[model samples]
Target chain A: MWHDRAMSTTGRRVGRPRAERRPDSGLSAREELLAAAAELFTVQGYAATSTRAVAERSGMRQASMYHYFGGKEDLLAVLLEGTVRPSLDLARGLLAAEGSAEARLWQLCRSDVVLLCGGPHNLGALYLLPEVRTERFAGFARMRRELKEAYGRLLADAACCTALDAGEVAVRTDLVFGLIEGVILIHRSDPDRPVEAFAAATADAALRVAGAREEDLAEVRARAAKLAQG
Target chain B: MWHDRAMSTTGRRVGRPRAERRPDSGLSAREELLAAAAELFTVQGYAATSTRAVAERSGMRQASMYHYFGGKEDLLAVLLEGTVRPSLDLARGLLAAEGSAEARLWQLCRSDVVLLCGGPHNLGALYLLPEVRTERFAGFARMRRELKEAYGRLLADAACCTALDAGEVAVRTDLVFGLIEGVILIHRSDPDRPVEAFAAATADAALRVAGAREEDLAEVRARAAKLAQG
Candidate 1:
């Protein structure tokens, strides 16, 4: 009976047989499953990854996994929402912050870099699943549109603050984001290269283009100085 | 017997064969297959693209495609080598040209953007392909490493001409490339966006970050004036 109780329990035992687990908790089994799926999906392409693999990573039974996520697509939806929505919110907040346009824009870019790199592995398993990348994901298109508008607004604001024009802002925003994302590809291709170094270098480079003065801001200036020293 | 003779004939026959006969040289048919495959591979990814589908798109037999390129991987290699190699060589030539570092570097950047955007559809296709991206394809790693070194060298030269340090060159190079490639992604993602606008914007932004001014040279002055007027 003790063995049976221990077998069914995780961390604590409840006097129940074949229970469906707790109905509510912080990051329940379902949320955990989705998290696992997101990590796996981003690292390995979706077709290469499997539900069983996700279950293994999550330390749960395959049958129990289905009970939480239903299927791959459902799991994908949840993972996408969890991974992107938060970052999107962060971007919005940073862009909407009360500061000089350049400062707010800098914050927005920094926040995106943080969100993209702050994960189990940088950017999580989102890239692994191309299905969400395509036109099929329910809100993916809308999300992309919103993101473009937000970025555009941030650029416009930054330009206003920096005394740059719309054209200049558009170019700067495009290039900065590209370097951040583009270096991700390079880092992934060459695991030997330090992702942190690339991220720092690229981030500093981007800020320099944004007119970050070395004498004005000590922290970002220091980072840029280090990269320049390199 | 006459039909077989006509079918085996190369180039345009003296008589018409459009309605009742097929060409003998099969060169046109082969070219069509290559074009179709490149298009599909760019959009859908290599793993998802099939030989039969490529053949159908080309209006040729799948077996005939094998005769031309051996297999799909060979086809892909041809596309990469055929398309990207020439452009890369051109970029190298531009970078290596004898001039002031700033002049050569500017030429390299401008020519790179031009060569990369050589075709309307294939500009970003290489980056999109799974087989071609992330060091999966043969020669891609070596090519990428060489490209990086070349970029480093060009930046070093720029710093030397500008009397900046190695570290400064590194930072400047990162920002310059980041800005250029980043804006390229923006223009590519939205076809309606003017390419010239993107190019000028990126060039101007990079020049600004590099501390370039009208006094730099007559050419820089000319380009800057063009951009300012635009």
Candidate 2:
């Protein structure tokens, strides 16, 4: 199921040859444009960021950008895709993997935090920008909903052993997402902290939000370790 | 301390005459511009929202808006102040009022959620816009930090009796703020739910984030009730 969803959504063939893919370090014109566009969009915002500025930032001529992207909106679409696709792919993989629900959630939370914090800036913060909420970005919104639903399913599974009902599960799922995303906001305020610490703390907080009992967290942590090894 | 900070920051005299204040219904042209600007800025991105549009939306001439605000940036500053001042005042009141730290934190969380959800759009979300994070809005950022400090103080006081240490209190403070702010994001995704229900649930979830033990939650809820009555 995960493989089917990933392949369909991203249009990538299964087991594609890595040799055909370009590296992310501005080696290709397309990747260079994307890297430059992401920085500009995040710093100056979507409405204020222009394709011309993006080209200049990428050390390419303004006219060449049109060959790569049709316009500014297309650049933004690609950037949003860059942010959402990897998380969705990881979520699908984890949801399909064999492990207890608690352990799976821990893994998801940790990886998500690492992604949000490992970036040059808190790129996740880009989602909160007003421009992204408009109709043109409806696809980003849909992808976000898919990620939330993935969290919802894992949370529901984890809550099955506890006294939490369906309604509680739904509310807790949203809160847990907020807890994870909140780390990005915190990093914005204090960026000097270690990313590993934030990831570990967020995973622990996610478990608590999912209603894992204190005594049970030890076992859940052990399971997470085993899952990480696999 | 809270009172002093709030008063100095907002620059309003205590016990000011109500008659000195302009009514909020656009009865005054300045109020009209503010109302229209808030709606426009919340609906359209700030960079996309023009002062001319704000004036047209308010049924005034474009030149008339300049009498109220110098430009679009000034209009945004006013709109942001409108969002932050009321909450700062409320936080100050709650901090200065008589109650346990737990009860005050509950009141703050519940009322903040109510304010965020009660608006036609999630005005609290305006803070997340990339445009708002720039140098022009440094004052807004400082005000936001002050608000977060207010929350931190309350959480620290509440955690005094618990096993939570200084670092835990700080982490929990950020998480609780995120949980509270997340309500706005959730409401954006699912606005049909009752505002009161979201407020109640958020308040409960905040207490959980602040390290309230299950056994202690009953008393905290009772205190919240008493605080609400007063």
Candidate 3:
């Protein structure tokens, strides 16, 4: 799942399966610092969390943490790039196909829902991280901005292909994202609701609100019915 | 304008109308504490920012802050109530009237958009507060669940009144709330965007997705077009 070529650094390994299987052994200290930072920032938050805490958590000396990442903000930049860049790249590639706008959007929403929910915890931690919004984390903020733009472009393309208005596209994007967020919020509220089920419901709702044609609606109902029967 | 009850909480004055006319001295110490807590939790992740920092920022003794809020978790509860309760009450009030599903939903969405944009900064800040997800602020979490239920009931009623499918109602509510949150997020990111424009777009888009009849759509379009032209 790791995309080494995705990194522009000259010496970085590209498509090396061995490197991905044992990143702890393969990654430069900088990469390890970022992984550690992502976990800490997501769990303890950026402000209350400190470099020393990250160093201790990652089993490194505090001074080494500083050498790899100038400070907490730089670690945030690295973590955000790891989380957001590949997600957008994957979305852009998946969305670049000929299909019904409804179908294309369904595909896109599914990918996001999976990314958000297919974890021990939802990606809300990353999205809601305080550091990402602060001036000190401007690099991460820029990445977030670009990610949104990329998603918007995908939605706009779907709208054009499907004959939906620009305003409608905005509505569709908001509904899909909000539904995903809401489901994750609900899952966090009650762990009993499997994220996958909610993710499926979210994808269904997203396609339906995009004004899926009758055939598409019937297809989804059939799927839901099948799930019930099975 | 504040509700009469809210205004009365501070009381008019012990003496005469002349004294009441004098601006209430800047935020009371308690008020400053709440405000500081809200801002800190919003700007820094709740886990990252300490109650001590809030106290220091507000220039109040940390122990004194505990007197008002009890603890950091309690502070989150108060912040959410300050932001969420009024909106739920307003939504319930709007749902009480008799109208077609479209009209009723439009009213709720309109009010929600207005309320959301009314205090853009605090609204987003209060929402993405990290502590909100943890059970540490159960009261605040209950308020959110109740708010969602209130919105859900209104959507269900509209579905019954308009003859829409139950599934469609679920989808519509998700879509409507999505538009509300999305508009708020957009306006927060670009504070210069006129709140009125965002509200109108939200209302119109929601109406469209809710499957407003041609007559109702025409009415909304006319009103929206006039607003835009003006």
Candidate 4:
């Protein structure tokens, strides 16, 4: 009976062959949709972008778009999730890893700067959109808070390793995030700079903002190398 | 002949008495309009705010509002001018003043941080609105560039004194601005922090980002005191 049922299912199935399944651009349908949405949302403000426009840009029928996202807000939620979640995971991993707080913080900053500079458009810039501040995008805000808290913890740890006080640690954490986010604005104004150089400079600035002592820097750099190796 | 004409006009024309001319709030209609527009634009946004809404908020009819400003864009331009022009003037003043680059840079950062933190809504945050990036605000962009260039020069001078290379100086200048703008973001997240403390911390972080030496900070602080006296 089981064999008969399995045989019947094989005969009735009408799936596209594996060779024809992938799109010419090689992005999955969901990824293509996200890529299209990110482009439109970045170039044109999210309020002006429509589901139909996203579908058209993705080379899919408007009807098929619904299969991927519930609506426009969902599309944005997904796009932000794609950008924020990985960083959050990495931050959590770094926080747990064995290394000096300075090294861990440096690694986080370097990786984050790379991510901010990696994309064609800095997706982190989307956080500045007024629409993202509304209740509809509360999920994005929550994830952002988690990322910020991660920064706060790393900063506090770094402060402990250094001689910085609690009050200053709180302030420095915010400034460090700002310094990282500032790279996006700089990139927007002058996109010609090499990303690697920008990332390295931003990472070094972040350490400096945390009040890293000159003597500890050599040790931090050594630890940073080991952290990178992992 | 001029005195005779003025006397005749004063005697014949029914001008409101000086006391009657000024409003109970002691603001002219134009000033009242600007104050109202800043509040509305900061709470809502530029595109979402309407001229009629601004007029209503200002306790004037739409027609009367038009007498002060041509339209909503003009209202925003005036508000931005009020914010940006003063900072630009201060930057120019600092650039012209005689002092070590560190002292001049410190003073600019301290004063700018105060301005960014002084407002009820951190008005500098308005610069991040996507609508503000459009052609209508090219004047603001130009002023911002002048401000950034001032920062670049000061940083380069500091780097020269510190023995940092040209590439490092370029990187630090962008990070310094980022550190300052980060104050606005920090204020938004935790509005309870004392503005004085935030300003102090930001100025210190900025100097650190520029690679200020421990031995030189005391001299910079002394010059900052002298600069503040004026």
Best by DockQ: 2
Reference-based TM-score, model 1: 0.71
Where does candidate 2 clash, by residue pair?
A: none
Q: Rank candidates, DockQ, best first.
A: 2, 4, 1, 3
Give lDDT: candidate 3, residue A225.
46
Candidate 4: list runs displaced more than 4 Å: A1-22, A61-63, A159-161, A215-219, B1-25, B159-161, B214-219
Candidate 1 CAPRI grade: acceptable
- Model 1, runs deviating above 4 Å: A1-44, A50-64, A77-83, A120-135, A159-162, A190-200, A211-230, B1-27, B81-83, B118-136, B160-168, B171-184, B207-230
Residue A178's lDDT in candidate 1: 62
The local distance difference test score of each candidate is: 0.55, 0.73, 0.57, 0.74
TM-score of 2: 0.84
For all candidates listed, what's the TM-score of chain B alone? 0.68, 0.82, 0.73, 0.85
Q: Per-residue alpha-carbon lDDT of model 4 for B54-149, expressed as tens digits?
A: 888877677666556779878776676566676678889988888688888988888878877786665665665566668888897888788888
List model 1 lDDT by residue over A1-230, tens digit each.
22343334365443222233434435656556766776676556555668889877766767666555557777776655554576578667766565455454454455455555555543332333335446556685466456656766766665332576776676666666665544434434444544454555555545655555534444644443443344
Error of 3 at A58 (Å): 4.3
Q: Write the per-residue lDDT of candidate 2 for residues B1-230, one digit (tens) a residue.
A: 22342243468654321222345562566666777777777677667888789888877667655545668877777667666666677788877887689878988888888877786666666666677777888887877777788898888778433677888788878778877776666776677878887787778778876766556767887898898787
Candidate with maximal lDDT: 4
Candidate that beats the other on TM-score, 1 or 4, i.e. the better one: 4
DockQ of each: 0.26, 0.40, 0.24, 0.39
Query: Candidate 4: deviation at residue B19, Å?
Result: 13
Model 4 Cα lDDT, one tens digit per residue, A1-230: 22232233458522221221245888777778888888887777566689999988977677666666678888888777767787788899998987688888888888887877787765665665556668988888898788888988888888433566777677788889878876766766676778887887788888887878656666777788798898
Pairs in clash, predicted candidate 3: A48-B48
